[model samples]
Target: MLNERISAAKQIASELHAAQEAIDEVMIRIARLAGTLPAARRDTNMSAIVGQDAMAKVAQALAASGDVRQLLTDAHLALTATQKQVGLGTRMFGAGVKPPSAMFADEGSNDRGVVTALAQAS
Candidate 1:
């Protein structure tokens, strides 16, 4: 039974790592696409206010997506570390971990409301 639990944990950790990688890839693609938008051709007239507002909302959604992706990555890292600590591997926890971003500095503690809003908007 103990062995089975350890195996399941390791599998879950692996899945999380793969998911994080996939999310990173998708985000990169999205960033590239966003960069390709014709900003110079965008209308800024009074009649374009609605379009501008929609664009602003899209930008907000993208930022929220990035925040969620970072949180998932962090969860994946934590899970991977736990799996390693459980004798699943000899590798050290967070051997090549990236530094946390200032954007996510208050993630868990202060962003519940924001996350909820994003979730509802989506």
Candidate 2:
């Protein structure tokens, strides 16, 4: 029973990891599509304006990237920790082990990959 629960937890973690990886890949693809700004002009004043605008765009992109990065990091941490907790819970529950609860907290949260993965894992 313990082994089964641990297996289940690890399975869920793997699925979540995969889903996050897919999302990250998509974000990267989109960012690449957006592309970087062209080089600034040689004129100091004109270059300054261009540079400022470019910096603004870069800052916006960085902000967006930071949010996505945070989400991805959170997903990774949640997956690893949840897997460990589920494994521990399995041992604690012993003969009639119960599955981890938090795993279902984000159920139907518009993440098809996640939902599918959870279904497959469970």
Candidate 3:
């Protein structure tokens, strides 16, 4: 019985190690795909606007403005925060630390990303 228990423990450890390796592989693949996305979407015509007329120049300037950058930054932050919250909620509930409703309420009072961006702009 003792030898059987030891063998069972070894098998469990081996399975856990295999699961971790699979998780790492998935993470690496996700990172590689994310890295390629920006290059794939890059506009090749970016430099072709150099000889464009005044209206195009103005449009380009507006598009490149700090306000637009800040807006995008805020949106990214909000998305990241939402993702983190959801992940935390999942882990918390899985661990029996909190219920689903409690997790939802935890983020209800925060408009942190927009507020932070607006403050930075000022």
| lDDT leader | 1
TM-score against native, each model: 0.51, 0.41, 0.36
lDDT of 2 by residue, 8-121 (tens): 766765666676667678667656644544333442335546666666766676668768778876775565456456545312211222234433334343554665676679
Clashes of each: 0, 0, 0
- Candidate 1 lands at a TM-score of 0.51
Q: How big is the positional error of residue 93 in model 1, measured in Å on the Cα after superposition?
A: 11
For candidate 1, the lDDT comes to: 0.58
The 10 consecutive residues of candidate 2 with the worst lDDT sum are 89-98
lDDT of 1 by residue, 2-115 (tens): 688666875675666677777778777666645544352353333535456556655676687799798996786566556556656433222244333312223343655665
What's the residue-level lDDT of 47 in candidate 2? Answer: 50
**Candidates, ranked, lDDT:** 1, 2, 3
What lDDT would candidate 3 get against the real structure?
A: 0.44
lDDT of each: 0.58, 0.55, 0.44
- lDDT by residue (tens digit), candidate 3, 13-113: 35544654555565565555544444444544345344346435444444445354455445534533554554432112112222223333235435445
Task: Rate residue 98 of model 1 by lDDT.
Answer: 37
